[model samples]
Target: MEPRGVVLVAAGGMDGRGAMSVLYIYPGKMRGNGLDLVARQHLQALSEAGVKVECLARGAVSMPGITCRFLRHTPANALSFLPAAYYYGAQSRFFGAWACRLLDPGRHRLVVAFEGAAGRVFRRARASGVATALICPMGHVGASGSRAELAWPAIGEERLEEEYAAADRILVRSRRAAETFIQRGVREERMVVVPGGVDEEAFHPAQVRTPGPFRLLFCGRLSERKGIRQVVAAWKEAALSPEQAELWLAGSEPNEMKAWLDAACGAGVVRLGFVNDVASVMRQCDAQILLSEAEGMPKSLVEGACSGLATITTSEAGFPVQDGVTGWTVRREDSGGTARVIRQMADDVEAVRRMGASARQEALRHYTWAAFRKAFREGLLPLRQSAD
Candidate 1:
């Protein structure tokens, strides 16, 4: 049976139409970040499945067939922003609630909250008779390296816990993440593990490998928590001949780490600031390296797999690639070990090709957008029906 109404609240907005209109509320400005990409994919997939999607954001936005509303209120004056220290702490929640009431007067049958900040709004929606689900990316609750930029002393750990307890259902990206939520007191049955999907068409392997000095690519922010220093040390230890292999670091560098990165660059490390076409760069590289301290299933790993590049990441990445099967999973702090793996892949062209082939096969079989949509529908359909 069709759900009576459906709403999706997240930290990023979506733009598309579906059978049941989905309201997506994002916490920040719509940018080219990983969260934005995931939200876009969800909206696009839902639209393809014939569901209408609406988006709410604080800044610049565009959505087709879905309503795009920008809330103008600041968090300081907004009564709903909890603990009230954040710039938009109170206002975002109040405005979100108001927006929900305005857009969904009768209340949505199903409301999915995507981030911790959206929890209060979801609870309000539930109180108004909307069945709500909370969607949290893997590693969200865990204090990790990537969130340094987003950390808020005002929100605090207790507030995060309160939000988690309030959600009716929690959506996670991996088994590890689900475990984290369960440990936090969310019932096991209330948690759903749905990984982000990959764009196969855009990130597939080239018919032929691009010619270059065996390129080793790392595409993510250069933050200490991301293990950039570990990656650099590993690369240095691996000591691939300049003629044989070169390390390529792509994406923005944190301000605090700029001097360190500059020093590395002066010593011949190649760091390319954010690029428009990551796929093109992935195609040119032989392998993708990610030594993150933690992850909720990074898109880069899947992209690497789709592009037929061997991936060398930590266990936290949560990709299905097994050690020596599809790709390699190195210890988080073992830069020396990771470096050895990189050196081996750089030296053995045949091995790298074989691993790359396996990685692409895995991506095709398990990580496509269609597969993700199917899983998402299956996971949420029962709850949506029950709520109706």
Candidate 2:
């Protein structure tokens, strides 16, 4: 492990510079995004653990012993929704496919990268007799079918499949994602399940619940897939007036949801777009809901749970939230079921607090960032390399 060298071709984040002679190839413009934050955390962990990392990011970031390089520039318009997939997909593909040419796999033990973004980088890595890996963060593309939650372009599917085929191993965040791949003909031995982790220190319980209206926090894109529209509908459907519950929508405001939101939330909704300090917001709320139709372990749920917010999530989210213990799980997206649960929680504030407390306490021991990093390192470290 000490002598091995690794090269990373990243379209998004998760800088894989660990205890090895590693080189990172990533978009320079990536910062302040969820994926960027994750990359920073893991990169820091790898450094603290004594891995020698060299980074080729688009922007300027200062780190000790980590060499930072630039990609000149890449045009990305976060505001344009219709062309977002094409723009970002092409950007990542260009960044990933060409980034690795600067990296010589003959000098590295491994070359790892995101699916679709890797372009021909993995093929080149394989040609050099290097072990190639792809971080398959999502489920299969065939299953996505224009689902709002998948968040990638259909055009990138062919490239992703090719990269998967080229990689020696493909990494996934949950057993659910692995199952999706296996069902799609990917070998079980080729997949690794490394669950998501929360930064417990950053998302701890509030010192005291602030005196305010009963609040339910909803963080993530306010789309149908995230169950935002459903939550709003249920809020009205449950007949719980604004005095009973307040919904805070934090994240980008999708144009498609604004019309329905006005009718459902009215004065009861609080919108905070692109919040820099999510932990503080979590402290102000009573509970969190992420009744997503599908997901690869929503980080917002984990962050909320770590912050002692009672989680009202769906089983499709892939987290083990107990029915009434750690948190409540809604089986259906129908407004009535959600409303009923909301009404019950609103009536019993103490129960919500208790469940929230349990969420953080259990997470600190089991789902914290420390836990994730340990699992991540174990899964990332190759057995053959470890024996060295």
**Candidate 1 local lDDT, residue 387:** 63
> Where does candidate 2 stray beyond 4 Å?
1-23, 28-30, 60-65, 72-82, 138-143, 147-155, 383-388
The alpha-carbon lDDT assigned to residue 38 of candidate 2 equals 55
Predicted candidate 2 versus true structure: per-residue lDDT over 1-388, tens digit per residue: 2111233342224354434355454543547655665556556655555555555555545445454555545443342355666666656666575556655553456655666566677777667676766766654445556534435542455666687788777777777777777888989988877677887778888898788778989998888778787777777776666777788888887887777766666767787876779999999998998878767788888889889989887877766687787778886566788888888888888899999989888778777767777765666566225322
Best model per TM-score: 2
**lDDT on C-alpha atoms for all candidate structures:** 0.68, 0.69
As a whole number from 0 to 100, the lDDT of residue 305 in candidate 2 is: 88
Clashing pairs in 2: 14-39, 18-51, 19-51, 28-58, 28-59
lDDT over C-alpha atoms for residue 46 of model 1: 57
Candidate 1 lDDT by residue in tens digits, 145-242: 33334445334455556657766677778776787667766789988888868889999887887777778888887877567888888888887777
Model 1 misses residue 99 by how many Å? 4.4
